[model samples]
Target chain A: MPESTFLDSTELVLNMGPQHPSTHGVLRVILKLDGEKVLGTDCVIGYLHRGVEKIAENRTYAQFNPYVDRMDYVAAISNGLGYCLAIEKLLNVEAPPRAQAVRVILTELNRIASHLVWLGTHALDIGAITPVFYCFREREEALKIFENYCGARLTTHAFRIGGLQYETYDGFEKEVLAFCDMFLPKVDEYEELLTNNRIWAGRLKHVGVLNAEECKEYGVTGPVLRAAGVKWDLRKAQPYSGYQQYDFEIPTCENGDTYDRYTVRIEEMRQSARIMRQAVEKLAAGPIMAKVPKVIKPPVGEVYVSIEAPKGELGYYVVSDGTTQPYRVRVRPPSFVNLQALGRMVAGGLVADVVAIIGTLDIVLGEVDR
Target chain B: MADEQKPAGSPSPAPSGAGGVNPKAGPAAGAPKTAPPKPAAAAPPKPPAIMAATPWDSELARDLRDRFPDQIGETSTYLGQDFLIAKPDAIISILEYLKLEADFDYLVDITAVDWPKKPERFELVYILYSFAHNRRVRVKTSIADGYRPASAVGVHLTANWLEREVYDMFGIEFAGHPDLRRILLPEEWQGFPLRKEYSIVQQDERWVRENLGIESGQ
Candidate 1:
């Protein structure tokens, strides 16, 4: 009689999102389930598509600067940094030393802020309610630093093609130092809240296991790649904007599971804080903007520039036809690439673990759809 | 075309003036003496500073030319990065060889450019990165309008979404792509948005009217 009952069970098809809170923005994953075990999954994206690449072609080089801010709104500074670097490379000029140092400081701070948002929302997704508040408390300080520098909080276009558009606020160093002093203890507080919590570990460890090889195949990067035991970080791999000057260890974990990703991000926050401290100490005093032409026109060629964004390797491929407007601008968004591994990570796992897997991926649909 | 004309235009009088100052000035003021025929051959023609050194010592370019001579067209360097122009149909084999033998295990990105005036209209660019060497090279090949380049899914699994995106934005199909649906646009959407002929001011009027219940403002 029990075997007959098992034989009679029909598989259930579940549509998880396009509006679901845990799906992380408008991502819809269709999961084929047989009694809580997932057989197949297809991720449906592009819900927030704004056609950014198409828009890039229409706008002049300078005109398109602000648009990069809307993609990966959490790490707006990183997007701006990557786009600016690509354009600067096309123009065959480098940002002044002071500007590069300031860029490194602001971008690393943005990395921390972006990761804090990820920690908060990802914890919120997995039902750990308290860490979200602690995360915001730290993230608000980082945003305050940006507001002081750029006047905009969420979508801060902090850097220009040649250098920083706005000079540092009077006490930029002091304020950043104050933040670093407060941020380290707050990181400790976050770890205490969720790092070893039995419920947190139960939900995260071994929940979604993706190995290093699978990560490579799917073009996954950032903390996920590090979590899968690959010691690859673009900051270290290809030192850009004076990352080579800072001495900080890249964190990696061997498990390639949800817990490893969590640990990797937490350690990365600590390293980011370390880099910020070193940057502030070595922050030279000089001009912020370089000798850039007023009418920004890059030569006729194509260049791809990538930076170590908080989520992963954020690359901007710019093709110029000796014109003010780019012939083509392609953004290799980390969230979009990492989202490719969702199906691989979720297969054969319980339906309930799907939320944990999605949170582990830490996708911002703004970047995915852009 | 532009590069060849530059040297021809600039270097004509350099050898003549130098020789005129030393030996050939005997005929210089007199018209026929201005031509420094002997020194021109004696100088052996020094290359311009820009072309003095082959910017990137790209071993991959050499290997590609050696292995698949027919597929490799020309390798050019811009800003110290090598761009290998490959034959359109030979993209799959070139990429596979690079991935397997050359240790370019990572597919960083795949994108395309639209040249409206050119006969081979679409420029498909494949950006590949080698972890072992910590180097990046771009493989570029051109295709005409509506021609499908071979899919790179067989070379890199990450190409699945990238090829779909290329197809969605540029309307240049990937011949062997498993799922080549419109990625960023609706399935019922009309035209490729990234083409030079495609203006951003234009939109699918019917879809906009039906889906959002609003006029597209023309």
Candidate 2:
């Protein structure tokens, strides 16, 4: 007591990840703590770096499409969609209306699937355990739809630069319609489990509150931005791949808190179903692949095309130097940008809230490190 | 079934199969026919009187050139995205102006392209998006090997990790970056992996040998 200085000596340093389950992946957060309260946080990422940008420079444009799936493994189809659309833009080729419609169907299904994983894991992180199983139980159906469309369930390289590599499977439309029918109710069930739960609301209501302006400053996007009451979904903002044709609303929540993010994502899943139904209902009679040259050599230029990926604005910046290989392919991963807000979100929150904040951010470490 | 599983190289099926929707239905009713147009500003950005002689096309670009005529280089458009080339010294100032004046608040991405043969070998790319204007512009600048590009973290906080990533991959330093440490690679790891001259297989071999103590079967 006699030796007490102005600064608190009781502040402790806590390392919260690189292996901890609550971190979502290998995201390590170095937390400066004062008892249970977090004073500062430095997120140490790159534990899962596979040198994707380097890999893109080495591989041919077509060869690199598969690797894009590895970045955001939870939403691999969305990754494929963004990559193909960017390359298509660079190559100055357009996927046909039928192909575009099919692409939207697959991507929206994947978006639902991605949000399901987020809702499940986020609720579990907040201590509501039952929702995880319920989320997965429903998520399995979306994965099955992907499996039917493409052989791979996870990391399905489901799109090509010009169009879809594989045509819609024989029962693909029926299966997607089935998923659309099944998933809408499951979202409600998940909400029922966590939306009003005392533990869930108490843990999340006021925790990790990042206002809309702070979100913009930090470059946070996707559900987190929408949660902050910004109706800035890239799909609606800059409609890519015929997203303009689909009717849907960008779900936004006030308060920018963890609960807000939760509600936003939940609404998004329902909206994704609406988009899928429209796309599948009008599943047209045409080819899935666009006509292009045998060897894909885009002109010497760069193009940045972004999509409203489930997590956020997933943009692919492709620079082609009149070569089969890309001169540079920069992936503007939403999670990577969104993760910048974590320090601001966690600064004044409790140590336990760090997990909820991390979960609320819905970061996939593969995308972060890539 | 075997035909369905065939890979991409084979002759693709014609696009006019029984797969598409009703052509007669047209696009779904009530869907917006077009995306929202670029947000209209009340008055077009006034060209800075300093560089009135310069042939700057866009209002924002002209304003940037007028403010820092020395730093502003050539401006071009690639596939609808605008590119504003800025000298290394002028990047932060130009970015600050864009953030404050032009409303390019969202710093979308920061990356670099390697050109081993060129004298100014590294072309750093900064993509910025403005929610207000609903527009995107790419700011690019080239730096010679070993030249440090000023970090945009001071102008935009999001540039912190992005600059770290560029530094990690290309081995280019950003002056004034708060934490200029390797982000994607181990601290002890040697050599920049994304440069044009760096051999991927060789780097992998060396990294595995040094870090994991195992022979990389390359």
Candidate 3:
């Protein structure tokens, strides 16, 4: 080896996106690169910051339910469930059995839909176009159930404080069962298309490996943590919204690489289908709403309620001042926290792998920049 | 005691200031008190139910108190969830103790609540989860306006952006943060958006005008 000169080994600064097709949203990552290998990355977010926490302080508890859906717009039901559960816990009331069952079914379906979107876009990011089409076809079936039940497709305010806002529509359970039966086989079909294909595995395998310790250090959760063989799923760790009743397995992998994360997500979709089927069978005949007050003023208290969303542990920290409006509402969006580890995962990797790493993280800009 | 003081302190001028009822019309005004106030309502105002429900003698609370005397202020529960209030200076040490000894390894979130009227204006909350114990606990500390609490980055790397976000939202900085710039807002933004006085509609108008070269719509 010869002595290196300053001009021979210089780093170049490249701006990826404030608005680019592959970024999925307006996430601008400034990259410092030596040729193609990335040295460092700095994310410039907040293009979509709507000051949602500030808005929650002004809105009443019941009035603020819709805003939570807009945060993680892909998994709208999980967001709604977390917000409603936090308010319900603050009010010291439990949703009726029927309401809890319906909530579990809807949220599981939303989890499938969210992962489908992740699968489609993630594969698309790695230049696999066929899986995006196949994944969206299944995702459309899930969204159809959402639209038929709540009259909204994307940001469905499906649940109210202490219960569901709408009763299960006619043939709701039947449609959900049919979608689960149809969606599981599609998961296998996706596997056949890209799971072991040489090109797909070549791009994603051993790319952006964040181990269990690094994941715990960065507070990363969801499939990213599970793929590190942590086996820590919030639904199983701390059950809420009647999740204790459901039977499902937390799929984990040992490698903690991008490919392992993909395989873990695929297995998770199958497990979500299993949970939905069990939830529908447990749906009993009873009142869908609880005995909540019309005024909806919770006592002076605070509660932190977290749910296993598609992305990770979505938390709502609510403080009530014994008034109609809340004193403060802090949302612990998993995407925002998990996005912090992007620099850690992408550094010392090729520039092309940055897209793969971002894709595997499955971050939603709506939640990250909320 | 609270009810007796209410009738003794302000009833003299309250009745006259409230409406046109006069001294001669006392019987007409007082006739609506047929149903007496309940005994439960007669008690002094409660402090958030959490302050009353949680016993200070839990095993975990006792262990923390034994280790850090006078540093553990309140070990309270709300809806079967435990939270500890710690002295601001002892926050980092308590967090390290919880992680190393008590098995609270996961730093779930770091956020602050702004109380404009309280002498300690910023209430910092660190939500933690212990996978080994299968439990979640919150560690909180109160700080004045300009006091910077120790950053948890040394203990958990997750605190880097979480502290930056708290600083961006509430203007509560953390001491020894590696990169403590605004995470959510722009670098040149003026007021903290999550403070009590900062309304939802308010923006850094100069930031908008200078960056976009247009008047802010709001």
Top DockQ model: 3
What tens-digit string does per-residue lDDT give for candidate 2 at B1-218? 22232243222342233232211111111011232211121222332322112243788877777898888778766566788888887888788888998899989889998888889999998889999989998888999999988888887888988889899888999988999999888877788888878877756667778778988735
The digit string of per-residue lDDT tens for model 3 on A144-218 reads 999998778999888878686566788999999999888888898999999889999999999999999999999
Residues A1-370 of candidate 2: C-alpha lDDT, one tens digit per residue: 1234566668789888789989998999999987777889888888898889888887667777888999999999899989988988876789888889988888888888888899888887878788889988888988888887777899888777788666677988888888888778877888888888898899999889988888888788888888889889888888888889889998888899999988988898899899999998778898766754444667667788898888888998887777557888899999998998899888878889999999989999999998
- lDDT string for model 1 (A74-170, tens) is 9999999999999989878888888898999999899999999889989998898998899998899999999888788888877777887666889
What TM value does model 1 have? 0.89
Per-prediction DockQ: 0.17, 0.21, 0.22
Residues B1-218, candidate 3, lDDT per residue (tens digit)?
A: 23232211111333223232112112111212232222112222444643344654578788998999989888888789899999999999999999999988899999999989899999999999998998989999999999989999999999999999999998987899999999878899999989988877788898999998889937
Give, for candidate 2 chain B, the lowest lDDT window spanning 10 residues: B23-32
Model 2 spans > 4 angstroms off: A1-9, B1-5, B8-56, B204-210
lDDT of 1 by residue, B99-214 (tens): 88988888989998888888998999999888888988999899999787888998899999998999988899899899999987889999888887877888899999999899
Scored by TM-score, the top model is 3
Lowest lDDT sum, 10 consecutive residues, model 3 chain A, at: A1-10
Please tell me how candidate 1 rates in CAPRI terms.
incorrect
**Best to worst by TM-score, what's the order?**
3, 1, 2
Model 1, residue A230: what's the lDDT?
94
Q: Per-model i-RMS in Å?
A: 16.4, 13.5, 12.1
Q: Which sections of candidate 3 miss by over 4 Å? A: A1-7, B1-51
Candidate 1 has an interface RMSD (Å) of 16.4
